[model samples]
Target: MSRIGKHPVPVPQGVQVQLAGQTLTAKGPKGELKLTIVEDLDVTLADGKITVKPRQVTRRARSMWGMQRTLVNNLVKGVKDGYSEELEINGVGLRAAMQGKNLQLNMGFSHEVIYPIPAGIEIKVEKPTSIKISGADKQLVGKVAADIRSVKPPEPYKGKGIKYASETILRKEGKKK
Candidate 1:
């Protein structure tokens, strides 16, 4: 038995959830999101709660039980409160700015890196060195943050690069003279 699958996902106020065949759609103040459940699982919404159960006693069905339940929970929370990711530039000249609908990054390269912002995602540069990315989709927000960080990942020696606001760098000692 899956521990997480047994618990039902509660529908918060101001959020509407609808189940149609294999697709589950959630709409709230933030936005609306949809998820397609696997055929091996059964999903139901009742009494302001969503429940997930396996249709058969199979290995794959059992393995996906908890994951599908968590996915449903994420959908509910995402539509209600949304998600966000923060990045910080550590280098001296490194900075970020919003150019029209794209993110312009200056990370010590010869040319500025232009990252086109996707639809439904918002990127803000309150400060030159700090970036805040927000959206209703948690996976997309995280993916965009990671993609931006990959452009200039922090180095171990100087730790000069883009990193998550909550991340820690493990600095390395310089060579002896």
Candidate 2:
């Protein structure tokens, strides 16, 4: 009864899917992604679509079935449409900037933090407070944004932290005098 697993994945043009033994390899214009097939979780390719049907829904299978299908779908879409994440810095004097492909961050530290951008991904800092990340791989783009935000996770007090632009943070007030 998993909504995600029940959904069918459409086979897009220029993308190749190969089911070899217990492994699935998806190749697209962007890149190739591979995953090991879980036992008893059947994936069938029919009529330009992929379907998932688990023989028995155990606790493990129930939890993983939906995730696996979602990952596969993302891979297919990533190769075609790509992905992006935006980050914002909130604080006085705490900002982020791009020095070429490296990110320069000033987050309450005496020295500026430098983060190098990975290949196949592009980072653009609109200002000291806004950063945009774009890449063909959805997972890669999300992971990079997470790593950058982890550098200065939003503080509960004063809400000074690096967070996704669309994220909302709970602000904690200062202690009473």
Candidate 3:
């Protein structure tokens, strides 16, 4: 038995969880999130808890068991408290700002980069070099943050560009004369 698959997800107060067909939906104060269960796994909701079990004792079924359980867990957590990612901009003139619903990034590029915010996602520029991305969907929030970070990935030489708030850049030695 998979460790994570056997663990039951507990539904918190003010949160509702429902299973219709293969789709699981969670509604809460933050927002609503839904996830489709993959084949070879069974998901059941009972008494304010969700449990996952493999349909068969096979390699594929075992592999997907833990993954499916985690997906369900994420849905519950997302609807309950939501998710957020923060990015830090480095460099002399590098900065981030919100222009309407889009994000304007000045990362030493010849032209400013404009990143359009997706639905259900919020982007806030708290400071000139700090950016916060929040959303109910964990995957979507992470993807958006990765896309933004890819725009100006930190370089090893100068260690300048966009990086996660908790990320550490390895500084490279400069060339000797």
Pick the TM-score winner.
1
Worst 10 residues of 1 by lDDT: 91-100
Error of 2 at 131 (Å): 1.0
Q: What value does the lDDT take at residue 134 in candidate 3?
A: 92
* CA lDDT of every candidate: 0.96, 0.85, 0.91
**What does candidate 2's lDDT look like per residue over 97-148, in tens digits?**
8788798899989899999999889898888799999887788899999999
RMSD of 1: 0.6
Give a tens-digit lDDT track for model 1, residues 20-135. Answer: 99999999998999999999999999999999999998999999999999999988999999999999999889999999999999999999999999988989999999999999
Candidate order by decreasing TM-score:
1, 3, 2
Q: How accurate is candidate 2 locally (lDDT)?
A: 0.85
Better of 1 and 3 by TM-score: 1
lDDT over C-alpha atoms for residue 72 of model 2: 74
Against the true structure, candidate 3 reaches a TM-score of: 0.97
RMSD of each: 0.6, 2.5, 0.9
Measured with C-alpha atoms, the lDDT of residue 150 in candidate 3 is: 99
User: Which wins on TM-score, candidate 2 or candidate 3?
Assistant: 3
Better of 1 and 2 by lDDT: 1
Residue 12, model 3: Cα distance from true site in angstroms: 0.7
